[model samples]
Target: MYNLGGSVYWNRKTFKKWFATRPINLKWMLLVILVFPMFAATWEMKKSSGFSPLQLLGLLVFAFAFMSIISKKTKAPNLFFLFYVFLFLLITNLLLVFFYEGSFSQFGDTIRTILPFLLFFYFRKHLNSVIDIEGFLITFLIASVFPISTLYYEILFNPIREVYNTASRGGGLRLSGFYADLFGYMSHLICGFICYCYFYIKYSKRKSKHFIFSNVGFLFVLLICLIGIYNLRHQASWAVSLILLSMFVYFIRKQVSAFQLFVFFIIALGVGGYFYTQIFETLFAKDIAVYEGGAKETAALNGRVYLWKKYYAFWENFNVLGQWIGAGFAQHEKSSVMMSGGMHNDYVRFFFSTGIIGILCYVSFLIYLIKKTLKTRIVEFKFLLLASVIVILMYSISALPLLASGALMYFVVAIASQINKNIV
Candidate 1:
């Protein structure tokens, strides 16, 4: 189409010549750059109730196309860890229908619930460049503040009128930020911490100019998450965070040094202890207007023990075969005068919806994921993801947030997939 230093006709052939020089990988990075905003905005839309089904559909289609580009490289999905759990969910639901005559609504709920996992597969395929991937992650966490900040502002300043009328509601003054519910906010906060901790560890080695900033961000996010968990008064969340942080330290002990780790734990414990008093006084005090019997009300730890007991009873009723596929989820909906809700436990939800066979399959899949992550090369990143996975598992014991926070769990798994690939 062109001669050396000669006038060339601008045509498709000439365009192709120019395009061929650009790297295919860069194209994928560019796709991420373009898509990041859409994802960020979508999270915001969920808060505002602003997005339409059509818009969401379009986003999913674009995501699929983006993932398709990467899928060409690998013959099989590298994300079998995630897919297996998905298969568990599907098989469980089908079994429920066959045995328990599960509701048609369960199918709709299941599909909507699993969409994040699909998007994660897309993320694993399309994320080509470190810069692009990291940039999108950082942006998502940063933009999450929009919803968080607004909730805090409203709680502190405007104060929800209904909240003022209901004394039991007052203790939940903890800022949810952008998340829809208390658990949602805490879960996303944990995810943010994973990103913060991993990136801090990763970049600290390179002595990059951004190292200080990363450390500062890590401290900030960790503090916020800890406080957020405390404010949430979710016993499971606090326990999970402590366990995961312990694991993070254990995983990094070789690199961080014994004295440094000791100091880190001391500082963390001191900070958490200091805030414990404030949180207790503010959220758990009997004298407070929000006190619906103080310790008794706030002390139920979100009624987790009760929830677990109920689910246990339900589990006992099921036979070996019934336990394998579950009694079906929708059937568990017992509408009482006080509430029309069922068990709040994720394990219970899964068990009832799918049965024991499904639970085994799902648990096995999670174990495989952790095993794969252990095998991965990027030691720090894998550790961070593994810690987060542990937190999600433990937290899920109490709060079954299967379909919340833009399906962040899947995103975690997708990022873990990348870690698995890059590690070994």
Candidate 2:
């Protein structure tokens, strides 16, 4: 009974210090845990009785973030602009949902779309240094090896032959890995590979043994990703990757000689030309045909142009304020277009779902993020932010990268904001 309470208090203080100072890259590990399972969530959704692995992981991350805030271990950023834009969008969407008698799913989906921004802030708080960012990227690259390996095995062995029978379809082999489909797999791969390239460029000259190992590991991961991209036969991913590579070259031009630049350009052009030729021969070489009604058709743009036209036609029915929320979801199902997926364009999707206000909010958000990036003092971080923005913009033209797993784009912006604030 002699000072028992004092002893317990001292023990608690010691524990907190140990927790705070513990090494082993806890923040990087947390980011990896948060993101890596997303690749496997689609597959796990079928096997699980309730929430999928991805959802559980999200809840866990959220719990940790909430506790951190409560304990004062980390403070949330003063994201007044972002908070205002998000709140406005949410209020408008809620009003629309009420007026249109939208389903709960519609309201929930809207919330889900914006939820990533919250997670982005959580990550931004933890990723407080360049080393933290680098560690996170490396962890992601390592975690990616599992999915990539599974994709290769499935392609080569076809363990589930019935499930993969569609690989020989007209568009060539499409390896979905553990994702819902090939497109989902491509999205993750594209973003992860771009981050790997950024890290490689920034750390290639470091003399640290750990960095040397990281470089070699990243090279292997890059090779696997390249092969996966080829097998997936996604033109959008290919185009984005080519654009990012070119940007990387331009980014490093000052560091390399003129002759080096020329050689790099020549190699890039040669490789790109060869890849384009193969894509044309293998994926787009369908025979032209004329219907009995004298209609000529070719497999141009993989029918994306026709899909865009149909969505545009549907957009005509919406008023200036839009049909409220869930317009894209509701209309896509009712329309007789027979499209295989959601609206391929994010801008069009937003206009239909949230109307002009939605579009304005989105544009303003981009402008703000870009302005912040421009003000960043770190050159590597600035280039990474700009490259990511360009890639996301390019991706938005052909696909909706602002929703679903595409929320990762906001994660990049959040990181940029943290860097600008001198928090990282």
Most TM-score-accurate candidate: 2
Assess every candidate by TM-score. Answer: 0.66, 0.71
Model 1 TM-score (2 dp) = 0.66
Error of 2 at 402 (Å): 2.8
**Residue-level lDDT tens digits of model 2 in 1-424:** 1123222111345434533553433553344444654635454574666546655554554466545545546565565364466446544554444345465544445454454545555566666755456545545554555565677787678733223312212454466655665654564576676676565555534454243225347446656666777777766677777787677667656645577567557756765797777664454433211223232342234555566666767666754444443243343443212211266666655555555555667667767767876776655566677766776577777675655543244344444446345732
**What's the distance in Å from true for residue 279, model 1?**
4.6
| Per-residue accuracy of model 1 over 50-135 as CA lDDT, tens digit each | 55442465455446545565655753245555446646555455444534435544444444445445544565665554544554
Our model 1 lands, by Cα RMSD against the true structure, at 9.0
Off by over 4 Å in 1: 1-73, 76-107, 128-133, 151-172, 177-179, 206-208, 214-221, 227-233, 251-263, 275-301, 304-321, 328-342, 419-424
